[model samples]
Target: MTHWPDRPICAFDLETTDRDPRIARIVTASVVVLDGDTVASRTWLLDPGIEIPEETSAIHGVTTERARAEGLEYTAGYAQIREALCEAWVRDHIVVAFNASYDLTVIDAEGRRLGLPGLATGLVFDPYVVDREMDRGREGGRTLQAVCAAYGVTLTAAHQAEADALAAGQLARALCTRFPQLADLDIMTDQAAWHAERQRNFAEYLSGLGRDASDVDPQWPIRGIA
Candidate 1:
């Protein structure tokens, strides 16, 4: 069997208006394509048209004023993002995202908000879930920065979409190097099962604590409006 890293991968990431993926507007996005070592990237900054709260702006360094002044219109920016992802998939590259669910969810939501058809995020690889599954006993944080550190991949610009996307691709390469089984797994099928199992376990845990788990989405890669 061939190593997954030998194939093309489109690593994606988004900087958003807030933490809620369902409603948060995309402030910036990056799609980094990796074929072996050769790399190409596309990035976008968009005016979300909603006020970016200072607290959220502090994270990705895109204040509402700067966004309005320098960024593309939200619809145009999101259209470019969608087109890039579609082009990557059409080229047979699997889309890779750090925590795919959140990023993809934002994409789905944004597309719907713009009255565009939902994008298919089925053929996607999520290093975050794969790492958690493969190394269940690993201590400490599982954030992009922490995981990159664990894999000896330097993540220079922490919250920026372009830097994060490139780092995610590098991290995926590291994981595939460490666990050949991960490279063999079918992301569309096997990963859906894995994500469902993870969600089920999480829901059960929440249920034990008397918290409602009914709204927990089991969708892998992307989640649409519930």
Candidate 2:
């Protein structure tokens, strides 16, 4: 039997209007299924219902005009994205994301806005967090592109959702191979708890600096409703 880490996993990513997960509309999204080192399947969504700001479009290449002409309404577009992810979960595939917190939190906020079902936080694998925890203090940067280069994974089309999603999947596979701990099933089971501890630690550090820590959420993969 294939080890859990080497099996098919779901890699997801999103391109949005802005960085704030609470309000950004997803302009493009990709769900790429990876089996070990191979990409087995892929899905893409584009033209999310809102106006795409020029700055955002410059980054992701999806313009407001293109979105208005081809994209589904915001609610419907999100529904499609949600259904694809939920189905991946239902099939026992771990959803892999580069920086899972941001993507999942954004998805959660979008869910709240659309009245859609929220994602199960525990079913996620975040290469970014795992890398940071296991290989601390070794980096100049930790963005997806940075991490990919660190892992010797090539990431073409840096901000494009499908390319990013595919690269993230490759990064996960690479990390699992390099760090045996990441391949274990326990990573999935302990993800939420781990994030809680991480958040608490950061909150404490912030508290020492006189910053409020009460609002820091410990929710890992998917933040609770906005």
> Which candidate tops TM-score?
1
Report, for every candidate in turn, its global Cα lDDT versus the true structure.
Answer: 0.87, 0.80
Segments of candidate 1 deviating more than 4 angstroms = 1-5
- Model 2's C-alpha root-mean-square deviation from the true structure amounts to 2.4
Model 2 alpha-carbon drift over 4 Å, by segment: 1-3, 36-45, 210-215
Scored by lDDT, model 2 comes in at 0.80
Clashing residue pairs for model 2? none
Model 1, 54-118: lDDT tens digits are: 99999999999999999999888888999898888777787899999999989888888889888
